[model samples]
Target: MTSASEPDGRRQGASAVADVLKALIREVPDFPEPGIQFKDLTPVLADRHGLAVITAAMAEIAEGADLVAGIDARGFLLGGAVAHRLGIGVLAVRKGGKLPPPVHSETYTLEYGTATLEIPADGIDLAGRRVVIIDDVLATGGTLAAARSLLAASGAEVPAAAVVLELPGLGGREKVAPLQVTSLQTV
Candidate 1:
């Protein structure tokens, strides 16, 4: 329902979301290590319009999904907001060890090491469900890929993924090849 209008009377979903993020995203050089310019989205998510615009846009991209699988950390924010707006349930795909036993886990490589993502295996029946993976940023796509694999293992159909920001230079999009990724903004 939240869309940005252009002079041509057309809606610019990604452009509108990008405009909001460009105004609020914080940039930090050499974060977590040297030569890394970190795009901190704290300010963006904190702002009312920023959050609303992104949530609405992502919800549109995740249309037709029966369930929303929010990746660990920031993904939870948008996932919950979108799912609520769409009147759907949000499944928390937490970090490794965050959930109790009987969780489906998928491991992926990071820049320095490896990380794991998990979801409750017994409580939820993901089989035959259409799921959309939501996350705050798509940097390298490892997390997104892992989430897709984890969800698919549960017999869910991961048709697509949505993210607030994408660092294209990092090859995140290419890393998740075959998985359509809709990003609100790229910087």
Candidate 2:
């Protein structure tokens, strides 16, 4: 049961969170490779207030999700925070070779190369679970698309994905067509 005022409060909170992200997120050019600008969210995640605001906003978007699957590395931080806020479990979608044998995996192409993501096939029961994928940024869409497929192959229903930032120019949205994506901010 929520009051009408609750929505207003959340809206205001989300706006504030967006401001925090925009202020703290760093833009570094020629990172990892030439002619590429990378958006670093490490500062935001390290800030106490920033973490609370972003986590709350992400949790709001993940309301109906039964489970939260976070991409390897940075996604793990955001996913863990959002899952904790929602009182749900956070599944770490690990990088290839990080997990032991008997795992579900998917590989996708990156701008520079190809990478694989994986999850345990034996320990967790993903069948019939409603999941929301969380990540720091949506770039090529390959990572996200692969993650969604991996989840589906394990019998999970991924209704939506939440990201802190999205590079629409990269055509990730189009790449993962049919999958609703919610981005806090676009760059």
Candidate 3:
């Protein structure tokens, strides 16, 4: 019986829910590799609305994202749902050795020389497609930036990147300044 404009208390509750979810995120020291304090989103993902709210926010920011590219691992969880909401395709940007034959790859600098990312040529047709890269955290921005480059090589247009959390102090923002970046929670 409520009008569309009428504030649905339930829907309005999403923000509050997001705040708590943000709090639930745990910091794991030296995970996946040393000197990296990974922002573990598993706890947040376990909550129903936590995941729903995150996906909805990412979708809203994506606006006209024709495709959603999730950087391997955690990125998949967010990207898959956002792709569903947008009724578009999802692309997976994986580690060097993950993709099968006919894959496109790009290499970016690490503290060392470089690291590589790959995307299956058949994963998604990037010709004239506009994609939004999604990830759980924007740390050094190397992975996300590399993913963007890989998508472009496939002939896709990447207008933005979205993450659940962004570590502002890490200079990740400066690395991706050219792209529209959005994070539900920034630290």
**Whole-model lDDT values for every prediction:** 0.87, 0.87, 0.79
Query: After aligning candidate 3 to the native by TM-score, how far in Å is the CA of 183 from where it should be?
Result: 1.0
How do the predictions measure up, each by TM-score?
0.92, 0.91, 0.84
Residue-by-residue lDDT tens digits, candidate 2, 1-187: 0111122244454456567888999889999789988888999999887777777777888898999999999899999989998899999999999999999989888877889999999989999999999998988799999999999999999999999899999899999989999888788
Query: Candidate 3 residues 29-131, lDDT tens each?
Result: 9997999778778988887767776777777777698889998888987889889988988888888998788899898998667988999887467899998
**lDDT of each residue in 1-187, candidate 1, tens digit only:** 2454342335666556677888999999999689988899899888887777777788888889999999879999889988997899999999999999989899999988999999998989999999999998898889999999999999999999998888898898898899999887777
Q: RMSD for each model, in Å, please?
A: 3.2, 3.3, 4.6
Q: Which ten contiguous residues of candidate 2 have the minimum total lDDT?
A: 1-10
**Best-performing candidate as measured by TM-score:** 1
Of 2 and 3, the candidate ahead on TM-score is 2
lDDT of 2 at 82: 92
For model 1, the superposed segments whose C-alpha errors exceed 4 Å read: 1-12
TM-score, candidate 2, is 0.91
* lDDT minimum window of 10 residues, candidate 1: 1-10
